[model samples]
Target: MKVTEKTKISELIKHSPETIEVIASVNSHFNKLRNPILRKLLASRVTLKEAAKIGKCELSVLIEKLKPLGFEFEIDMYEDSSNEKINEVIPNQIFDSLDVRPILNQGQDPFQMIMSKVNILPLGKTLEIISPFQPIPLIRILEQKNHTCICNEKEGIFSLFITKNSNEGLENNVLEKKIINKIDSFDEFQNKISTFEKENKLERLDVRGLEMPLPMVTILEKLEYMPKEFALFVHHFQIPQFLLPELEKRNFFMDYFIVEEKEIHLLIYN
Candidate 1:
């Protein structure tokens, strides 16, 4: 018989009694009249309180709404909550026993170094140099030597705060601002000239960045071309201990040495 909008469900069942008989037989054994997929779809449509009932008014309203949407469904009214109980219990146990392991020593450490030197070549009143990145530890050392380190990462300019030899300690508090104003802009910093002579040469050279080239090696190399008396080589955790022998073969001079910043232990290079 052709299924139509006007077709009565009871009339169709009467005409095909075997279909009802098969469903009734299955229901007798399983106590489930509707498929699980259809039950879930109905659960989403009907209110929770109405979904729990076999033939609730809200369920009838949902079924009416679903009919036009190509779904002809019925509720499977079973009293068992065993499946939900099992689902809730198993998840916690499964997650608690999960194994997630991490690999060890898979790559070289970026901050690996045996020993390094800070060549604080004085430029009369201030220092001029280029570095791979911000040399914070070296700046601290310069500060200890009564020099203020003003670093501008954006313009790639560094200046040391200095005062007249006699008035050095007196102007310590205003040193940072003094050095900052000197390199206020990239144009000012690039044009400014250093007048530190050999006898009172205060330009510090840190060739450590040259020893261990950073990701910005091209920039460092370009800066190396510019004429500057004393440059600083700020060494960090990048220079490897194993490469120190090969580095020494290249005749690199070392002055002030520190094993690490936190620990003030000086490293003796053979």
Candidate 2:
């Protein structure tokens, strides 16, 4: 099969099972692909372009590795100008800055803190995130919300600048409300689930025991082929911060019941 930087790792593996080993050899980070579950979860969400970033390797390296396996390259990887653009700076008015290193040091998730700032972000104003490494998943999630992001790395530190586009209609308060609705009350959550169940249009999925990103991946894959009239009932471990913006992008509304600190039930519907 023809391959490009945009080609998904899953597609490459499906084209040639040997790709699993070949990709794993690229970097220690990719060795997780040796696990069937990790491969299924990660490969689907990542492309060769993202793999290169996540693995901290060059795209040409991946292309070269797969070339021996008869995979056709879509572009001249050696001369690709895309890498030059990775460091291009887009000037944005910085309104707020968040350093997540301390949060990570405390063994805490900074997603909530990041999203809180993102939700109230003013148009044409940028939110700067300081991190030890590129937060690719967080970048992807915010980009799905129509936010523009430019990331630059220096000395193993990544500075990501994100701004909401004025043309995306983010200035509309109604649209903002529609984009971030969280039903947290147990009574309200139960009522919504009961209503969906009674209509016989509730589809069930359990992503409780899955690892990070797997739960998000599983939920997104299920939603892709979900019937429009039906709602998805998801048994999850926590409110998936990364998944929330994606659902909002797809115009899906969500409600959740916090059964415990680690057990949560979500009702997602259009």
Candidate 3:
């Protein structure tokens, strides 16, 4: 396959697994690709274009690095277009906003916080996000959800304005209903867990002790290769807010119960 700016990293890796190392060699920022779990989570969302921006390197750098691997590239695909401006207008009335710089400073993931606000934001109303740098992954995810984005940067601080499209009411409502049904009560969660366990179709993972993104990464990796008949029971410190949306995107069924401040049980099935 001929590589282009829009080619997804996951697609490249799937085509040639060696592409992971080649791409990661372009910049130190891409070293995370060496982690199998991180690769699975990020590669699917990032394109060669976005990767170049995130890596703070020229697109030609990535293309050249992968050339030795026998991958073909489009002519002049490395030309810089990062200064192209998006013509989206910011809404006058901001419905909700979040500043994730503090969360990042604390070594925490702000994805859950950001998604929570987005889930309730009304159509035509805007949600503003302030951060230290451009959140390319989050922006990509939101754009996929039918939100238009406009980003501005000043003195190193990034302000992102996202507005949900007025035409997405039906689809967003359906997703909201799905979110409600996916959360099970304690009794319901217990019953499903017991049934799966009795049938020996339950897999267990404990992510309570793991760090911020590790827990999310490990869980997704397990789900990626999970058997069709198996359900995964994860022991987590608190509700994995970020994982919920990802699970929904993957068409996975989930049930969870918060046991206490530091104990949460989540059951994921196909």
Weakest lDDT window of 10 consecutive positions for candidate 2: 168-177
lDDT of 1 by residue, 131-186 (tens): 43344333433455554444322233222222112223332222222111112343
lDDT of 2: 0.76
Candidate 1 steric clashes:
19
The per-prediction tally of clashing pairs is: 19, 0, 0
Error of 3 at 96 (Å): 7.0
- In candidate 3, what are the lDDT values of residues 1-270, reduced to their tens digit? 888787899999999999988888776889989988677666887788777776777787888788887878874653554334323344355788888888866656777667667777877888889988766556766776778876666566778888878444423233443542344478787888999999999999998777665787789899888898899999987666556667777778777787876777888887
| RMSD of candidates 1 onward, in order | 32.6, 6.1, 4.6
Q: Which segments of candidate 2 are over 4 A away from where they belong?
A: 35-45, 78-87, 92-95, 133-136, 150-156, 166-240, 243-270
TM-score of each candidate structure, all chains considered together: 0.18, 0.57, 0.70
Best prediction by TM-score: 3
Q: Each prediction's Cα lDDT score? A: 0.30, 0.76, 0.75
